[model samples]
Target: MDILYYLQTFDHFIIYLVASLLLFGLGTFLFKWLTPYSERDLIRAGNVAVSLKLLGKMAGLVVVLQSAIRSSINLIDLAIWALIAIVIQVVLHLIIEHVFTRKTNLAKEVEKGNVAVGLFLGGISILVGLIVAATISY
Candidate 1:
């Protein structure tokens, strides 16, 4: 009976793990699509700015997913929260790039290897993720 209970728990763990991974992949895809430049190409070319920016985005999404996994009532709820987190991160990034820094062309700067802007954007992304994660509690 104890073994049976453990097996059932393991099954749930697997389900959640797979679901979380899928959500993470989807979030990353959407983020890349929404960005102005190709993060993959930039990173491949040894652009530390793009690398740092992408890292922050990934880290932010992971933090949000962690909260969703902990607080969600079911798999569906987890999925919903994960989507919300992705949207929030992407939207906030756009807002910062377009609105907050109207004078500066962030995309161009990032492409030109502006580490300061990259670090600022990366820090903001992580900050937004932390805030969004904190709000995910039931």
Candidate 2:
């Protein structure tokens, strides 16, 4: 293969990579904003439950985004789908916090380092990610 040809392809790859990173950052910031409590503060206080939940969200977002990137026909398509995926994730989080755990306050529980709540949230996120990823198609 011609070295120059390989080098030229790097430009588009770099662009895609940068765009993906930006989307990921935006999604994460949005998640923080949507939540009722400060995840950062909870994690700082050594809350393993909060940490696990956050980790799951991050992992889920990446999986969804990876699907969007792989199945997108163009950059614009990727971006649009990414935004949709983010919205879905936020909605899912809300449902988990409010609807599913109606009797219990998930945010409060997580803040108090409840590992059961954290595990549930973490597993839900991963499951959502897989489902969302599977739904994406070119």
User: How many residue pairs collide in each prediction?
Assistant: 0, 0
Per-prediction TM-score to the true structure, in the order listed? 0.91, 0.92
TM-score computed on alpha carbons, candidate 2:
0.92
lDDT of 1 at 71: 93
Instruction: Count clashing residue pairs in model 1.
Output: 0
- Which sections of candidate 1 miss by over 4 Å? 1-4
What does candidate 2's lDDT look like per residue over 26-105, in tens digits? Answer: 98898778777899988888999989888888888999999999999889999999889988977876776678777877
Candidate achieving the largest TM-score: 2
- TM-score of model 1 (CA atoms): 0.91
